[model samples]
Target: MSLYGKGFMIWQLARCENGNGVEVARVARAAGLSHVLIKIADGPYTYNVDRTTRVDLVPPVVQELKKNRIQAWGWHYVYGSNPVGEAQIAAQRVNELGLDGYVIDAEVEYKQPGREQAAKAFMAELRKRIPNTPVALCSYRFPVLHPQLPWKAFLDYCDYNMPQVYWQAAHNPADQLRRCVNEFKNLAPYRPIMPTGPVYSAGGWVPTESEMVEFLDAVREHNLSSVNFFAWDYGRKGLIALWNKIAAYPHPIGPQPADIPEQYFSLLNANKPAAIANLYTDDAVHITASKTVQGKEAIQTWHKNFLTNSFPNATFEITSVSGTGSTRSFTWKGVSPSRGKIENGNDTIGLIDGKIAYHYKYFKIT
Candidate 1:
């Protein structure tokens, strides 16, 4: 739900609507925003908190956004200096805010000499605390340009990739976005790309309304799920015309239920058993040709064993899907490195409040 349609990123919530939660939500709804991302933490400290007043600025906005049927995602700028501390603060903000999703904003500092271990540490800790919540890695658009950013480390846990495709001085947004997508598609532990376009002015370089449209057009041309505008405060104040243009864009703004199976397949490909298990209800049941398993912990163990031992380094692909109401039927195939392959796989799932309550699988190795 967080990665569907148009999204707006609010760098400083207090700067917008004079810190009025209701007004901020009203603006998001007026602009037809599907999701609003707010900065929750910076480094190892909680952001958007009044240092002197001792007030948390996010809960009200998050609450109001939900009332408006909009997703509220929290973003944090992480420095590799204290990965564990950062992870602790991020997870704390997420749970306390009741966010729909979380984004890890790892940038220049992450490209240091040795942040791979730090990246691994941060993600491991964060996932343990909020395994089921959808996580995204927000970073530079072109992965080739920034090889040292530990793309695999953070992406292994991320459900989406929100690239900062900010065409600051250049007008070639379409080409840059295309290049960004191509570079990311080749990365392992792949996550769906959701681009972030530039909406603010910088150093006398302001993106034209046409450029914003082209950026969004490129998002659709590349079959991306959604597009986000950076610094909502700047966009609303300085680029009202561009903001209006984005609001009028014809992209259908909402999540599709049919995407559930593909999302599950993505997690399978990411090789995260904890995440896969979290997608199910606590009392969920999964049945296979060999045996049946119930409870989330059992499901996690089953997948951990199956994915790690039986089908280590396997790629799962959905062949087809058909469903009605709460029930879905799908076919998938998995090819493993040393264990050969599983084919003709068919499965049925029953969703309860967006979490899988029942799953039945049938497959054969050939």
Candidate 2:
């Protein structure tokens, strides 16, 4: 959920290297993309499923992206017709794919009368399934333009807003983008904005390479931590000029971890054992299945050996966390190259004077 830097949306799986997951991941990694939003569900049904073979096409891409250390998010386009069905499909696909984030792409359909209640129902049902997953609302760039899209109903449950600031048939990306940010800030229950810009062409008109630069500059000027493009199928392989322009732009990273638990998990993903051990006090003790280690140096060595020998090139993700004043309990999962998958990782830690004093961990890697 802590998405940062540049990302691109993938609309059609087959269009990109004939739906080869490894190829898609290689493309994303080469572009230095922090995340890739793959289409997961459309209305009440799942997307990216092979019609003839009846096999889900999303998991391969999701697996490949995660292996490359890039966040693979799922996006759904909703019509608010069958809120429950849509919500169920949303939950099913997100859980099945183990997505890093979920995006609700609600558009003009929610603007119709009597759709606000539907939005509420959809979000409530969706939350019941994946309560810990980060969700976002990707809708119109300007809420003022579409006043009846149930923005509050969706935004209340969302962790971020990614407005589609396409600015189609126009060259004023900076002006339009700035205005988009200003408007969203005033909306009720405003979430962190990670606006999406146009990388594809509409009709015969295309966004000039300079216009893309202007848009990125405007996003950086607003100090937003992240930015994304609309479509990979459209511009990434189609238009080299715009793609290169976006590549050179240094999209800023997200803020630091907010808490001790977050910092610890982040260190695990960063694969820095010494830095991770620094979070504990000098006399801290770590309890595990094999042995109990005391002191920072021992703790560091243990983690280093674990990372190197057990799960090399692995990324750990905290699935859920709960805690009190000086104690915390968290569940995590990890994935790595060479088919390493960790599903059940439960840990509890006791903090003393803002530093870890006692840590107990239980996990299985298969």
Candidate 3:
């Protein structure tokens, strides 16, 4: 059977509530997560030994997770400065702690001179010590963005590719996850991809509960083995509702529908008012901020005037799409010379017989 499970990565053990390992394990199990990845080390010397708790937290966390029948894996960040030292530290920790698996988090520091050789040295030393342990390479989601990082060198020695597919600054989780997996497959050897999504709210942007569900759905649609979120502390404290919703979400059972938002936006961008109107039923109604237009003819006329006269160079971009059955809601943005810029654009489309029967749009122009 496929390893279809939900998991979360913890950046630091001390960050957990009161630095309690049992509490951490209970929270994870309560969230329906089957596994947890805790940071055991950073660089060559900084072990995640909790300062406030004044104890090594990894063993207790692992022990608690094991008691709960949840897999506990350890991860370490490699700075690529002292490859042998980093590898030795990682190997020694893994051996001492006996984790279910290990993850190598290599980032910007690896994208420097002699990076490939450094990665090779690290992986060689790591494998020499723990030859049979399952290891994964976790790094930037898009290989194109970090071409200098020795992706091949590290992945060749690792067992899985755990890309940090944090959909920050954008809400299109399905599209972004799809693109991330496709890009990695094209560049590296085929490996099971267990992508990590975002839960933390930073820079005035936070993901909604619905969007998080859509991300899990996207992972299931791709037939991936597993899905994980970034950090545990932020999620438990800041996004409690979203966290509960994720735990309660049921596993998708069937194939997902074809992506229709792309086509809908395509028609809008093409300035084909008639073609766009044809996507709706003959008895369809369009609702806007200023007025409501009933019947397909009236809707067609309204679109024609806006597309041909008002916003001739308008372009629509969809950030998120969600819903089930016949109702769907999409968040978008429109740019045009006439309107200057349309932000916070939202549309709710109700379908009947595979055609739009009710459409409502709202936006703010600046």
How close is every model to the real structure, measured as TM-score?
A: 0.74, 0.70, 0.67
Tens-place lDDT digits, model 3, residues 61-161: 88889899888888899999999999998988888888888999999999998999999999999999999998988899988888999988898787778
Q: lDDT of candidate 1 vs native? A: 0.88
> Candidate 3 — which residues are off by over 4 angstroms?
1-3, 52-54, 251-366
Among all windows of 10 consecutive residues in model 1, the one with the lowest summed lDDT is 251-260
Q: What is the C-alpha lDDT of each candidate?
A: 0.88, 0.87, 0.82
Q: Candidate 1: TM-score?
A: 0.74
**Candidate 1 ranges beyond 4 A from true positions:** 255-366
Ten residues in sequence with the least summed lDDT for candidate 2: 250-259
Residue 188 of model 2: what lDDT?
A: 60
| Residues 68-152, model 1: lDDT tens digits | 9999999999999999999999999999889999999999999998899999999999999999999999999999889999998
Tell me how many clashing residue pairs each candidate has: 0, 0, 0
TM-score for predicted model 2 compared with the true structure:
0.70
